[model samples]
Target: MSLDLGMTNAPGSTPRAPGRLGVPVSAAEALRYLTDLGMWLDERRKQLDAIDQAALSAPDQSDREALTHDITVSMALWKAISDRYELLRVTFDSGRVGPVQAEQLSTLIWGRLDVAPGDGREATRARMPSGAESNLAVSLPEACRLSDAMSSSLRARLALETTGLDVSIRVKGIRESVERIRDQVSMMPLGATRDRTQRELIALEQRLFDVTERAKRGADVGGFLGPLEVEVAARERDLIVAASRRHESERDAARARELITALAARGDAIRGLQAQCLAAVTPAPKLAVPDVRALGAVPDDPDAIDALLARLGLVGKALDQAHETYARALGERDELQGLLGALDAQVAGSPAVTAAERADLKPMRDQLAAVLAATPVPLVRARALMAAYQSYVRTVTNNGRAPL
Candidate 1:
């Protein structure tokens, strides 16, 4: 009898019979079963190695851990397969079966135990579980084995069918749903509201455009004739005032130059008189007048005495004239310095000059003014008359040589 157990049905649905439990064993069958088990083990080992390689090449720590978990699960599945194979080996060896008969017997035993159907169906379901319940129930080792078997079965099934039928059905359903949604959306009043909003936006844009155009025109007018006009007018007024002040400064400088020249001339005359007085006080060289008794007796006469007194009187008059000249020159120098001071005061008091300039000129003017004010009137007038005489001479010389 043959057992056809399908795991899709509930457990104990099929009746258990004795003959269907095991088949006659052969050595060839046993060897074949062992060979198949060995191949499965080798494949599982290769799969574990691949998982290890994936873990090594993983991009992040989390991915490496996931790949290592997969390798551990594959190793577990390999161990399970080895256990099942050993159980089959024990059954076959006790029955004294040939290798070929052992392989058949093993297949029957596995079938009777309902292990083969459970493994194959669970393997397929494990690959792509129905829902969260199947996912929770399957171990990682079982999932790895199921995934390999189900993927191979799916590929074979797909190869036997016509192309693109499943995709066409999905595409049709999607198209219908999309069309229904589009029709419902088209029936909405959103299009009218959108049009109204667009019109309002256009009106606002037009107003903004007009305002920007007016602003551009205002900017152009301001650029052409704003602060620049005021600046130019102010600069022109400043230039005129500066020119007037410059003319006044030039006149003042000329007056100062004339006063300095007069003072220098007077100083020279004073220095010359001082030099003359110093020379008069110096001792003259002595002459030797020995062994001339008659010449010495003639010098004691009255006529010689009267002539010597007249010569001394003339020397005294010349000395008095030189002193008068020095005093007059000094007085004249003080008067000129006073005039320079007055001119400086006028410049300083002018509104055109700044406060700092006035402060600088004021001290110099005060010093010269004090000296001139302290001088005696008679001396000052005499010095003034002398300056007038010098000025007349300079004027005449500038006019070229003439009869005096």
Candidate 2:
């Protein structure tokens, strides 16, 4: 008798006793059970195809996601059932399908097929079993043959299906690749080829639409997505080249900014110290500093900028030494003489200082006074005398809090 099974309903079917679960008790019965489920799944797939056709224009993102998941899950379930059925058939043909073995196989098949996933449903038709009680969730009895929890007999391989090629996995991979390409297109920076790539993008999108329509109609998806994949790869290559050129241009621009900054710093240094250095020398060379502020015509090459800067003024370690000498000559003579006079007055009036300390400080003060009297005091002597006098003054003052 033909048995009608629902996810949640009276377990027995046809002339079977009431309240008894209608599980197949033999290999032949189990095979029939799986075959019936295969047919049922086909009908569900057809319904999904119809949904795809209906949602062609203005498809909802969430609905498409849901539909994809449903298709994937249903396909997986159908495959599992068909494989188990083939295994049973092979074993039965080989005379290995014993009573206990058949019962175990039947139970495994029922557990998988008799329950629907959470949030999944058949809206157009009512299932005999309500599908509320998931057979997968129910713990099978320990006494059951396949329920051993350890070293289970289900380790055997099922018969493989070789009659037809299954291209579902291929379609899934290509669709995922297309999705990654779509994401990349959005983030790609604008360039000379950007507008052209955008046009190619429109064509790529149309191909994806055609692929979807063909998939719904049960046509070959690989043929449609294959060319689309090639087109996508080409655009990605173009974008990479564009990005490389843009990066080189950006690097040149950044180098130009650095050149401007260097010029400004050198201008500040030259303006402050150039006159003093020239005045110190008997025969000074004529120096012409370019207008650093006007750089609209300057080339971006770093090497060229450095050459221009070097030619315009004194630089390198020699320039640094000159700057140091200029600063010392300009201020040391006057500043040291003023400090010595202040120390002399402090010494004469202080109760903290002795006559001996005053005598020791007098000679250094005289030397600084002699240097200041010279017309253009030699920078080297002034710097040395300035340091010597400063050291003596600090010793006499001793931080200004104790006797000298």
Candidate 3:
């Protein structure tokens, strides 16, 4: 099943508001929400289980420690959300909940409540931090939102950032890139081009050997890894470009050319998306997108073509990450703007909101609007303005009343 479970906000979007269980919550609506939360909790439980297994199997102490902490936080949040869900389910399952009961349910849903492991079997096993009981607390929606975010992040790490295998995987990838370049270089006709390429390969091999030795000895070679990968990828591109220029098998060259063309087109699309994201949000992620055109023409050598294909696969992955990062940023900005607009509308239409109160709220609203309307919206400033507006509206309209 897709891991897009729970009440998760998309990459850059704001989280959806939790269903209100205020006075007069409909039985049908409450039941439907409860059922969905139940399903969400079930999926979350599976996620937590998988995360726990990943923690146990983590490559090293640090990996294990980090994953373990994540597991704890996810679990604590899940339990908090789950507890309120149960309370609501039992109250609503019997039939209609009275006003007092509904008010209490609203508190359970929206109020900041204690969120520690209970004194049960599972709690005993958790062994949470000292005084965790007193320190950790969140509302039901907050817990659900946090759990969704943590699960998504931890899922990514488990898939891509398993530190124990990270170095080996990176080294293997670099090694493949190097071999592919070697194939392209070998297809070159004998002379200065071939000889020079051969010498470069030797140098790359030597560096690869040194990197391998350092890794075995447990030295931190991370600083060398990225540069090495880039160098090999660049060499592969140069070799392909050179080979494609040479007269060779028309069939193989055409195949290579087709592949490169497709990749270049993909690269162009990704770059366009990147540009849109940058324009849509301030403080966009700074990423160097891989340009397939840099690899040059499709070589006539079958082996070299295969190697180029492998390199293209790596490029595709890089582009995917870039796309996700930028898309999330854009989504977040749009969601925040939508939320600010929604809040402004809500306050303006509120029954208790007087003309004078609306006048008082106008400045903050306009400031927030200006910020949102700015090119590359300053999300931080917009968010702050939004919070101030919400707080101010509450104070103006319902100063003595308890917040809903």
Candidate 4:
């Protein structure tokens, strides 16, 4: 009679139970157990593939040998289990199975199978008689357990190796950063700032040396590496920032020199225009043109240069305002002269007034002309005279009545 055998619900990563040796299990149960083991073997095959790839690509000779050994053993054991499992699966599916087939399947699981010797030269050279150096004979359960243990060991070693590689890469990066920062610091002008920054770089280098030594001695330098990188990066950034600011200051200083020359020339021209405008027109606006000299020479410091630029901007604005004011005053004087000329022509051509009235208007017209023609024309007096002349002409033309 076929007997029922307990199995895991799913062929997952859970450890398989030891096989029941010489136990009577049904054909159906044996098939199910074989199917589960096949699934488990497929998972192990993927893991073995990964280990094989890692072993092949390992740079270190010792690591490669150790990993290769584990990979070889696990793969050989896997092939043996897989080969036996497949045979049992096909035998049961053929529908020709009886007591013999069932016993064979049980024996395959619970019994030992001879794993072939490796094709390596080392194994071949060690070959001996009496099966002393022959292949291993282990049950399916024991094979799976051994493969799991090897996989775990390989993964752990790989993790440690990966960590060491990461630390080494970080150290190299820190060293490169230190060199770059040192170059930047050397380029800085000799001063307390440069000296202080150089001291900081020396300290960082010392700390990095300590970390490298500790790493060489197989100490965990993970905690120190991160902070060292941060400090080095920060110093590099600071040097870059300072260099940029220095360039800006130099540019600003050059700009200030150019502005100084331009502003001085402008001030001279504006002062001359002011004199001419004041002499040509009365009641001209009196605005103080900014003296660019009061700002003095541009400074070397960035902040001082910025301040000087701001002051130069203000001076430029003041010059512009003063120029506008003085030019406008001269313009108004020209406009008033034009208006008076136009009015004088209008009144002279008009026939509404008698010769006696014309003679009466002559003195007032002469006074207005003299005021307008003077070097410093009194605009208030000129306007009053022009208005009086216009009023007289209008009264005479309209004959004491408003024009329609």
Candidate 5:
């Protein structure tokens, strides 16, 4: 028999009866259910998208695995909900009946459906059906049984999905923590400890990649473990390297400071010596003396006169030695001054242009010429010359006939 499955009243107006199949549901109720289902699906899709985004942004293998896990779980949940909804729709469309039967079917559907609790207590209580006499009578015939089976299947699937999600979240959190430690430890300066730390991190990263691969293949969750051990080892090594480098730097700086201090002190001492030399070489002005008259006229003793002449000779020798020392000092000073001037000219890019300056110093370049130039010394040469000069001076004085 052909059944007319049509609602007697407006959508969501309250069913008059219960228990029947092929009864038209209120348009409003159907639209609300579809809307709620769409929202749920959208939310799940968003979660999946978020997971994908997170995986792309992850810096390491561990985080990527974690995001993969989350996405898988969310997809599973979405599939389960969609499957149940499709099954329900197919079952309802199979049979058709009158408005009364439709009202009864709507009641039955509501009775079996498990409405999720809302955040507001009053709203939850209002929307939720209670296990009471009137409400119990409003249940549809086959609807409860079908809904119970579907709910059971959904619950099982949800449990599995939730477990996967939780595991993935936990892995991601752990991976993030390990990564933070690695970053902090790696920043330390290079040394034995830093090298050790780097090795440890590399090892941990390898292990993490293995775990991620296993997870992608849907292996045992327990397989993803051990990055922590590697991170700890790396951190310890890094700390040691940083400390060693810091200590070495401090020691080097201290040595340099000490060297600078010592050089400065030595420079001051040299400057003092230079000042003393300059003072010693400074020339003193000569003073003029007036001639003194003899105290008294007396008869001279020959022995006393001889002693006096000997003292005069000694005084003359002393004066000559003093004059020679002064002359030598002056010559040395002049030589030093000339060397300074030449250095200054060279520094200014105008080197001295003289024959002596350009001359190349050579040892024994003309030995034969040197030997030929040497003259044989004449005995009493200086004495003979002096005697002749003295005689000439006396002759000239006599010729002049001025004064004896």
Candidate 6:
């Protein structure tokens, strides 16, 4: 005799008692249960179509009602089957469910919870099943589908900042999280804690991936991401800040480019100025400016150019010293003239200077004027005049400070 192990009603009004099948042994066995149910749905769909064909032929109200109710129930069961199988598939991907555990779970959810939804309270309660039912909900495709908004939005936001910032690390994190979710984690023999831990980890990874995609989308994210949610949220915040910084970063880059270009031009200024300044002094054929090769071949990247610019500054300082030397060598006559004129003005205006000190300054001033008047004044004579002027100033200063 056929064993009366269990019974199941048809999708809708067909309340036929059913006999039980043997409990599944492996994950494959569990999959077969879903596959078999899918095949049953196909048959039920045909049954539904046939009922539709009959109603078209005869137009009976009761037949139409039965057809409509059957349609509703068929659609409902199809959705339930799809959802349940997808959950198992997700769980399997995460290394949570092995063969034996999958079979047991198939019995628990499909074989148990998917009973006749006749009573309203029972049907309502079935929709939100607790205890054993909730365990498998996170692995479903709907969970993944629900998270698409965040990932998609985050991807868009990150794309904008790519021109400004190195988002590679974050992008890699997101990609890896997504890949980990898709990858099959280590499938081991069915155990209790291992599955749960793996499940939570994989779920967290998936949730993080979802969180990234959801960034800037502003949609409600649905999943238990655990402590990883903090990471996801932090990453999302980072992406936002990175994106906001992009415009200003680009602007700063443009300014840096201008500065780099200007620094590069300093090479020519340095060479030219060195030549001009060294012309009047000990005329070296070529003054030594340290090789700042990159200045002439400046990089467009601001940070790269900054190092080269610092070298340019050293060259610039040498240029300054060369210019000062040239000024002293070439303008020595003007220098002596200015010293004589200053002394004349100081002697004319001062109360501290005695007549003898003033008379002494006149001869020094006259000597300085004679040196200044000489055309192409010898460099040695110019040097002697400078020393004489400084000595005269010191004497006058001392005489002013001392009692008359």
Best by the lDDT measure: 4
Q: In candidate 1, where is summed lDDT lowest over 10 consecutive residues?
A: 5-14
Q: Which tens-of-lDDT digit does each residue in 143-182 have in candidate 6?
A: 2221221222222322211233223344444454444333
lDDT score, residue 209, model 1?
A: 44
TM-score for candidate 4, residues paired by index: 0.54
Question: Candidate 2's residue-wise lDDT over 245-264, tens digit each?
Answer: 34434554565566557766
lDDT of 1 by residue, 1-404 (tens): 11121111211111111123256545654556466555655655554454445446556887555334323433444455556557666766755766565555545434411111122213432221211111122222222233333222221222211232243332232233223223323433456644553454354335434434554565432222212222222222222222223333444445444533544454455456555433322221121211111112223323454443444445445445555754455545555666554455545344554666556545554554454454332344434443543343333333344412
Give one digit per residue, the lDDT tens place, for model 4 in 1-404.
Answer: 11111221111132454348786446767756766787777777766666566667778988786555545655666778778777767767654558876677677676766566452335533221122244555566655544444444444345322332467766776676677678888889999999898899899989999999999999998778756655665465446445545655687799999998899899889999999998998887899987798888778887789888998999999999999999998987887788777766766666777888888888988888899899898878887988887777676666555632
* Of 1 and 6, the candidate ranking higher by lDDT: 6
lDDT of prediction 3: 0.66
List where candidate 1 sits over 4 angstroms from the true fold.
Answer: 1-25, 65-70, 98-147, 150-404
Ranking by TM-score: 4, 3, 2, 6, 1, 5
Name the runs in model 3 displaced over 4 angstroms.
1-259, 391-404
The most accurate candidate by TM-score is 4
Q: After superposition, how far is residue 157 of candidate 6 from its true place, in Å?
A: 24
What's the distance in Å from true for residue 322, model 4? 1.5
Model 3: ten consecutive residues of lowest lDDT: 6-15
lDDT score, residue 61, model 3? Answer: 86
**Candidates' lDDT values, in order?**
0.38, 0.45, 0.66, 0.68, 0.38, 0.44
Could you estimate the TM-score for every candidate? 0.23, 0.32, 0.35, 0.54, 0.21, 0.30
| lDDT (Cα, tens digit) per residue for candidate 3, span 1-404 | 12322323221111233456354465655666676778778877866777667667777888887666556756876777777788887777566777766666666676665556543335454433322323245556545644554554565556522334368776776676677667767777788768988999999999999999999999998767756755665465345334333422454467667767877787788789889877877777888788988887666555687677788778778888887887888888888788877777767667788888888888888888899899988877877887888788777656456643
In angstroms, give how far residue 309 of model 3 lies from its true place: 1.4
Q: Give the count of colliding residue pairs in each prediction.
A: 16, 3, 2, 0, 5, 5
C-alpha RMSD (angstroms) for model 2: 25.8
